[model samples]
Target: MRLWHQDLLTFLPRAQILGQHRECCALRGLGWGKKHSTIDYVFTYSVKRLVDYHQLVLREMENRGYKPDQQWYCPEYRGKNTVPWTCTLRDELDDIPDGHIYPEHDDAYREECLANLRKKGIELFP
Candidate 1:
């Protein structure tokens, strides 16, 4: 997972890692000790398209049959699930820094993220 993260950073240096979660799972049908926890990351770049990117990802996760944690999202945003997932940074800062929005990509970057997930063999279900 670390290697994958590093490679992704190398490829998308301007990407901002919004959040990540780590959980342990068995590997090769072995017991818990056989492998370490895996880290799943959430990233976004352009502030202009940040909400768009979030919507796209949530849609893909649903299409792929992956369950998203309800706690991390807002219940009443621009029409329920239409807004970006609740980002703590937004509350903390009046405006997102210019650096975070730079080196951003459009819809193409979304495809790349999905491809990376496929390569990692992440089903989230099944």
Candidate 2:
């Protein structure tokens, strides 16, 4: 849904206006944190950032009854995810914090994605 949906990219004008990677990263962090008061205007800036990847982009769009974008990862920037960080998406389902929930699927998901990437000769940008 996201890969093909041009609206997601255009929905958050701020993303396109973001001059630096840091700025985009900052906005992404904001959206993920659910400090998302600003998303009333459109879809969501965090969702727009999905354009940077094929997987989430497609996943999001598919979730919305849209066709998945046939996007491919760029080879040049494939192995250099110098972002060196991930957004802290605290679940806003409830304000009460769930203390230290262990992620049991981390290893499995990581291994699965890595294997798929290797099979396609796509090196992950770690």
Q: Pick the candidate with the highest TM-score.
A: 1
The C-alpha TM-scores of every prediction are: 0.26, 0.21
Cα displacement (Å) at residue 30, model 2:
28
Q: What TM-score quantifies how close candidate 1 is to the native fold?
A: 0.26
lDDT of 1 by residue, 1-126 (tens): 321222233233212222211111111012212333331122222222333234343444445555655432332233332443354433443343443322333345545565666666643223
In angstroms, the error of model 1 at 39 is 18
Task: Flag regions of model 2 displaced more than 4 Å.
Answer: 1-105
lDDT of 2 by residue, 1-126 (tens): 011122232232232222222333333343333344322322333332332433433344455455522322221121233332343332223221232111222455446545544665654444
| Cα-based lDDT for every prediction | 0.33, 0.32
Clash counts for the predictions, in order: 0, 4
Least accurate 10 contiguous residues by lDDT in model 1 = 20-29
